[model samples]
Target: MKEMEQPVLSVRNLHKQYGSGCAACRDARRERLLKNYCPACGTVYACQDISFEVFGGEILGVVGESGSGKSTLMKCLYFDQEVSAGEAYLYAYQEGRQNIFAQSAQQKRYIQNHLMGKVYQNPLDGLRMNFSSLGNIGEKLIAAGHRHVGRMEARGRELLAHVNIPEYRVKEAPKSFSGGMQQRVQIAKALSNHPPLLLLDEVTTGLDLSVQASVLDLIKMIQRDFKISMVIVSHDFGVIRMLADRTMVMLDGRVIEHGLTDQVLEDPQHSYTQQLVQSLL
Candidate 1:
């Protein structure tokens, strides 16, 4: 048998905590409050000893309830939150190296530009609400080296259309579109540069079933067409069953069970997994 290739992204013993007593720890507490926390303990550990690997051309789904660390892990992986310990390695082809922890601003820029794509729970947060859908998608392409501004606009329109948005809506501000339409725009933005790894954090939250399914179909099509590795964090088992090759069950910042999606779905071993499956049923 041919040996499997290395994963496009690898995380080991990753830890992220807010409000450590270390003098270097600044007041992330305010940010936490803005996110709907009241008198949030500074010592909250959102992710503890988390580890995972995402291979090229595969989808890994993370399933958990709210406050279960799914979004926290994504935040840490995307470098939006500070990691307290451990390392994450991102594959970089041009320099022929794996960037671990990516502390340097230059390193972060390299990954953000070339290797990573992200979609957030609130689609508007991922896009420039004031910009037209075309402009929102075009911004990333321009940043990725689309030198001709005219070509950028044309390309943006094409991508928006691909996501099933009307070409005529391309020039309208994202704020004017419905939530689902804004989500399509966000997906278009994330796909603009075609990064090897796509991180989706609760991509379908707050939408109606039909809207969620439509967005999901688009994601499925994109994954199949581009063969990009995806890490999707969702509370919905239906979403995981439809998208994942493997599934990881998280609860209280720890992985309870993980394996082939079918294997776990058919016969979950962990008590938490069994409970979650039963609840869904």
Candidate 2:
């Protein structure tokens, strides 16, 4: 909880447009709800004018209903999806001078391998189900250029244990593990390189309440142990309230309100945020 005067990542005026932009997109643009099909042109604006900053050792929560473009924004940041416009920079890379959006494929690959970790909503998206838990985490180390098999395997054991996954399961394929265990393996894989920034998208969405609690506890432990910055996307306020230091409320693909987690929860200014907080109450 030290003073975070510098941000680990900064995103400015980010946008993602799907389909041919036509006249209907104009209304979508005006309203900033460009994430859906345009009534006039049927263009899909998956994201528009998105901007945010994540500070070192801080968790920034992005909350919104499904299809609010929050997931699209995370995809853009992780380079899984392309952006139509705007810039994103990682402070840990090139001293925060390099724009991630403009990086060459090689440079981006290096960044992805060394400086970023992402846990997808689906374990299959983030992990190789057929690979053993150890192999899943080891792949990340290999990508980061760790060629020593012994060292990679050691790191894998360390990560799995750190995430509270039993060491006995290290050699088992994720396909054979339970849903929660698969998620733990995904988290361990994501953390293999000790990345400075971690992106989590709906990580607890489909889990049972007990499983969700355990996963959330594990994430909290990781955050404390690593002191890594995070951008967590979730529709559940309980998830945000439990983990985020700051929260951003997204509606119709736009951030309508954002501030300290306590402030946003206690004194929500946006109508949508107010409704969300009230629903919890």
Candidate 3:
């Protein structure tokens, strides 16, 4: 896909608070402690005033430590969690900026199925463990309005092969596969619909070093081949270094810094980002 000047995804002032508007939650937002959890009202500011843009065919990396709310940012963009406030627009869905946060359930469903694909850090969160690899992909296709069993299975098999799963194993349950393979299946399933956007949250987090490299390689290859835009969230700078064209450094759910990947990595300005870059050195 050719690069476009306009962003494929534009998110502004997004917030995801766990509890209803209590004084604690309001205070958390006011204090800018987006990662804070208050015992007073049991509110967790999982994400706050998060804003960014993902250009077409670009892999935008979001890096932050645990509890920094980077994952929550991706979750909000993927529509897995409801946003408490703010607006998000997917250019693929509409020309005018549509506040996706205000969209109806049906509209959200359409965006998820037709416009974006998501792969989670835990394969279990993304894949149907009990189903065969083919069945798993078929389910995603079915959600996208595919009903023909023959065509669905064929597309599923093709994707399994693309992901380097043995053709014979296509009939086997994903639960029986190794962790890395399960992740591969999840990737294949996510790509079945050829979505314009992909959301990957710590996809290589727990794998062995070599396995992580392999999975990361596959992701890079998929991006190159499909030319899909990706929002990848990881704490590992190595992953960000290998995959992202641009990078965003998140802290307390806020994007403290964002720029071209090399520029940000090489010349970090924020104190937190400077520390993060040095630690990886």
Q: Highest TM-score among the candidates is held by which one? A: 2
lDDT tens per residue, model 1, 8-74: 8878888776665333333433344423233434455566688888887899999998988899999
Q: Model 2 over residues 1-281: C-alpha lDDT tens digits?
A: 44447789989999887777765456534553334667666667767788888888899999999888899999999999889888998888988887899999899899899999999999989988888999888888988899999989888998899888887878999999888888898889988888999999999998999999999999999899999999999999989999999999987677889899999999999888999999898
Worst 10 residues of 2 by lDDT: 26-35
User: Whose TM-score is higher: candidate 1's or candidate 3's?
Assistant: 3
TM-score of candidate 2 to 2 decimals: 0.95
Best by lDDT: 2
- Model 3 agreement with the true structure over 46-145: per-residue lDDT tens digits: 7778888888789999999998898888788878887888898888887736877788999999888888899999988898899999999988899889
How much lDDT does each candidate structure score? 0.81, 0.88, 0.87
Candidate 2 has which clashing residue pairs, if any?
Answer: none
Worst 10 residues of 3 by lDDT: 27-36
Native-to-model Cα distance after best TM-score fit, residue 216 in candidate 3, in Å: 0.4
Clashes of each: 0, 0, 0
lDDT of 3: 0.87
Pairwise TM-score winner, candidates 2 and 3: 2
Report the lDDT of model 1 for residue 203.
Answer: 90
Positional deviation of residue 136's Cα in model 2 after best superposition, in angstroms: 0.6
